[model samples]
Target chain A: MTETELLDALKAALGADVLAAGGVGHDLWAQVAKGRVREALQLFKGTLGFNVLVDHTAADLLKWPGGHWAGVWDPCQATQGGEHERRTQTDGRFELTWRLMRLDEKSGLVEGRAALKCRVSDGEAGPPSVRDLWPCADWLEREVWDMFGVKPNNRPDLKRLLLYEEFKGHPLRKDYPIAKRQPLVAPLPAPEGRIAPEQLRPRVTDPGLVE
Target chain B: MTDERDPQTPGPGSGALTQGSGPPGVLTSRLDAAIGWARKYSIFQYPFVTACCGMEYMSVASGHYDMDRFGAGFPRFSPRQADVLMVVGTTSQKIAPILKRIYEQMMEPKWVVAFGVCTCTGGFYDDYATVQGIDTIIPVDLYIPGCPPRPENVLQGLMLLQEKIQRQGLHPKPGTLRPPIR
Candidate 1:
């Protein structure tokens, strides 16, 4: 289906859930209410033949000058570059973006791509996990949680994908200090267990520890 | 009968042997100088390479530049066997501990050479992820400064390290600190 047809179908199916919808280049783009993310993605994947989840990531819109939603605005659009007035909101938030693509089954070529985004309020629950629909969402969601602290509801394993276990705060967050250091006190023991036997006889008794 | 050539005065053709004139055949030199000569030419290096700087390092080690001529051509994969640690790229905070562990595992009398601007001073990445300088984590013996230093600069740095090794005592006295390399 064409971009407009799919968008019209979505608008008809999810009338109030979609806040805004339009075309950006050849791909269709939409902004939807955060709670309806799963339903909207399900419709795209199951009914519209958009079987592939191209990419998934979140943008911290806390300090964005254009607005919370402006973070995801396509810069390539002709109407985007004019002098715009800022609409400052008291509450900080994050915008979660997911790019989906449809492919022809026989040729294995991409037929269409659509960009969908939703606003996730900071300190609140994030959009539902789409791991069941697209297994690739597993690590992507984990990375979002790790970097932005946006907890995806019902995610089975939400461990930090990039940072170590002891890392305290999400470093990508706007509020996180850039120079704050969290040096490890001592090296963690090797995960593979002991590799060599202890020496029974040694020439030097004192092997000093590295400072 | 008086000999034409005096015993103390060397013959005209013996200039090569009589240049130092200390002894006829014995060549005397400081113990440190001899040890330094042997050590300078056989440095076994461990390259802790982890970024774009590795490209430059590869060039230095390859045939055109030939890092082997400086005695640092052989890269020891294990820390225990290496005498020099050449950290060749950006070291992130995440990798700092691993770098430290590798440095500690190397045997004593080992030296460290920070091989790029990133490893020496963190380059343009002055952020939380990058460890500003590797010297914060471990002592460095020499630093080669460049975004990705040319092979010629690396060779010059190697020569500087050789000079440093040549001046050190064979066996350091207890509690005596080796002079720091500028």
Candidate 2:
């Protein structure tokens, strides 16, 4: 299926959940309701055959303007509803994105490419863990958590992935200083099975020098 | 005491310059000079290669540049058997502690050569993740400052180290300023 057909199928299946949808070049993206991300992914995988989880990542939306629709035309201004739902997310601070791919089994080719995005408020928990859906999400989610401190519920191992254990804050956060360095610890003195200082060879081995 | 010098041996009490008897010339020299000469000519190097600078180190050891001509061709993989530590690359913050441990494990009287700009001052990697300079972890003898330093520069650095070894007194501190030998 083509990207447009995939978006149409999404609009048909998840009518109320897809807030805004459009194509960016050949690929397409759908702004999904924060709570409906897992449900949408399940639909894409279970029915539409978008089995390949291309990559899952997130970005800090700290730079985004409040209540301003970042689309081709303001979907909120065109909305007939009293108050557009997209205009009410003044508190939304992070944009979690998931790129998925549909692959043809017989010809071994890509059938479709689609992206799903959801805005998460600053204090809210991250989107549900997709480790069960795609095993690669295990580390990818952990990395997101490590860098952004966005906790994903039901995640078995949600600890720092790239930074050391003692690292204080998520370094990728906008508030985190770029040049800030963490305290480093030296290794323990004299590990087990290490050769004793005296047992090691003498420093000088020159024959001409008399001790 | 074994016939007070064998007939084949001829010299003035073992300290004289002999001619035409035992291989022509027999000249005596100070014990210090002999030791210095020997130590300078045979440098056992532990090349702690970690980054791109290792390519230049390879060329320096290769036949064209000929590090063997200066007695630094055989790079001892183990730190225990080495007299000189030739650190030849960028050192990241993650590897700094390990580098420190290696430096500590090496025997005393060892000299450390910071063999590239990265090892010397972290090169362009002046950030939180990369070590600013290896000297922050261990003492350095010679700093061969280049991105990966040319073969000629490395040879010159080797010559400087050799001179340093020659000038040093007994119980030689390889890189420090020791008092003049009496």
Candidate 3:
């Protein structure tokens, strides 16, 4: 759908939940409630003609101070050289960002973005799994889990993504260390001589422990 | 009745032969040395590739100076099989310990080749979550300089490793770099 049509449709469907709607260079964005995300996006895809699930990711903008939101704004519509550009609230929460490309054939170049502020459980836990709607969200969700330590419920593989298997802390957290590592044990030596035994030897240290 | 003039030419009887002065000795000894050298150089790496600089590390293994041709094969999935630990992307403080454990799990004589700017010096992410330099925890052998170096740059790092082996030799010494305690 056209930018105006999509914005109007979201405003009509979600009402007060659709916080802001606008276009930024070659892209459009709409801020909505977490509860209305699936339905609102469905409206955009089924009715508005945005078919492709271009991308899905999340950002943690926690540096902003309290009681200082200039109304929720979409980065896609953020202007480059505006005299009245204001900073939006960057509170420590998962701002779920999605990019949708219009596929009406005639209006295929148009793309839209929608940001939903998800209620992070325990103040830092990630959003609920979007895997049921978007299967590709699995990798992206895992990444968010690995980096931010944000656990999205029902994720099949919530283990570390970029970090090692035994990594301790989440590196992408706002408070990761400058330089440090937990203690590690050296590996045992390989068997000597040519004929390596068929049976494996037990490791010297506890295999359960991180090396 | 057999022609003895061209000994270099393989004959039915001379199944195993060599042009060197010495006899064809034990094949097992040669096989052992070959295996030893292969294990020494071709360290199957498990690159925890993340961020921008991982691209440069991939180039190091690509065509031109292919790492596979020179012994360092492509990365492996299991840490048990891999001999070298290459932490290619930016590591956070939380993940630092995990990277360390992976390094520790690699068998003895294992080497770590620190690739790119983020890993070697921690580059722009020298902040709270990101670890400044991975070398602070693990002993780094070769540090390739670049924010995201070219693939040839990785090959250059490999060549530098070969030079280091030529200088220090492959076997670990008493005090070269202390192995992890127990």
lDDT of 3 at B58: 65
Cα RMSD for predicted model 3: 12.7
Clashing pairs in 2: none
Once fitted onto the true fold, the runs of candidate 3 whose alpha carbons sit more than 4 angstroms away are A24-27, A61-63, A66-94, A104-128, A145-211, B1-119, B123-144, B148-182
User: On residues B13-81, what C-alpha lDDT tens digit does candidate 1 reach at each position?
Assistant: 232222232455565445666677678789999999999989999999999999898887899999999
Cα RMSD to the true fold for all candidates: 11.8, 13.3, 12.7
Deviation in angstroms for B19 in model 2? 19
Least accurate stretch of 10 residues (summed lDDT) in model 3 chain B? B173-182
CAPRI category for model 3: incorrect
| Stretches of model 2 off by over 4 angstroms after superposition | A43-54, A63-90, A101-112, A185-211, B1-24, B27-33, B55-66, B174-182
Compare candidates 2 and 3 on DockQ and give the better one.
2
User: Model 1, B150: alpha-carbon shift in Å?
Assistant: 1.3
* lDDT, candidate 3, A1-211, per-residue tens: 3555666777788887775555654355666655666677677666766666667666544443342234445354355443322333334355666677655566555454433343342244444566666677677777777776676655545877655666677665444553444423332233233133235342222223121
TM-score (0 to 1) of chain B for each candidate: 0.81, 0.81, 0.70
| After superposition, candidate 1 runs with Cα above 4 Å error | A69-92, A104-108, A185-211, B1-26, B171-182
Q: Rank candidates by DockQ, best first.
A: 1, 2, 3
TM-scores of the candidates in the order shown: 0.79, 0.70, 0.52
Which scores better on DockQ, 1 or 2?
1
Model 3: residue A149 alpha-carbon error in angstroms: 5.4
